[model samples]
Target: MPVKYQQETAQITWEAAQALIEAVLKEGAAQKIAFSIAVMDAGGHLRAFGRADEAAFLTAEIACDKAWTACFFGQPTHIWNSLVQESHMAPLASHPRLMAVGGGYPIFYQGRLIGGLGVSGGTYEQDQEAAVKALSFTGFDKL
Candidate 1:
């Protein structure tokens, strides 16, 4: 069934998204670990998605949430790590639609914020590596 939306949206270009995903997977070759990747627009809306053949289903959703959190907050997920880990902040740690882990990164283009990328189903460092590769693929490595 076709879904309905109250507002219209402009999605990220598929070619750009694909380029980023492929670069990320290539970067993971040395580790031989599969991953699920998600990208979101500057507004925190999902723009693209990809998963390795054997990646877990949940990884995709988590990846999206992670990217969304980073784009929406305009910062890396790890930046919120300390705040969310505090006892008082624990109550909000499991917020319904966001992630506070270290694997998502915002994408910037031409000196402006463009979108973000998220990678999961691998070690945090590996996931971060993948995200970085994706950003590099988009020519936003300086970010």
Candidate 2:
């Protein structure tokens, strides 16, 4: 048999990114909080982004960082807080793109990691809520 080291992986479409952004916005509105949102491909590249008029300016970058962090780690950005508590993982706290807060989640489809989603501008818990709601509402798994 031939070596099969490579395999196909799903990529999040531009339209899906946009839809996720819209879904995030909807959830933010429901929560009565403005949010900055970002979506990234599996490679941690930004695919789509948005910031509500009332969202803090800093939220934009935070949202992007959250998405990138989630994609880069293949887990929710919030997990970094607990993960970094380990003595050896503490060094990760210095990485510029590592967002150890909340509002970041890996996007999964059929057990395949496809991309990431992040939301900001509210409390970390609120951000997490919005991220999860938006992911499921958009037919993606928040894993």
lDDT of each: 0.78, 0.89
Model 2 regions more than 4 Å off: 1-6
lDDT of 2 by residue, 3-75 (tens): 9999887888999999989988888888789999999998888988988889999999999999999887889
TM values, all candidates: 0.82, 0.93
Candidate 2, residue 59: Cα displacement in angstroms equals: 0.4
**Candidate 1 C-alpha lDDT tens digits along 81-121:** 78887899888677886688888887766666677788898
Worst 10 residues of 2 by lDDT: 134-143
Which candidate leads the pack in lDDT? Answer: 2
Poorly placed runs, candidate 1 (over 4 Å) = 1-12, 86-91
Residue 11 of model 1: what lDDT?
44
* Candidate 1: clashing residue pairs, number: 0
What's model 2's TM-score?
Answer: 0.93
lDDT of 2: 0.89
Task: Report how far off residue 84 is in candidate 1 (Å).
Answer: 1.2
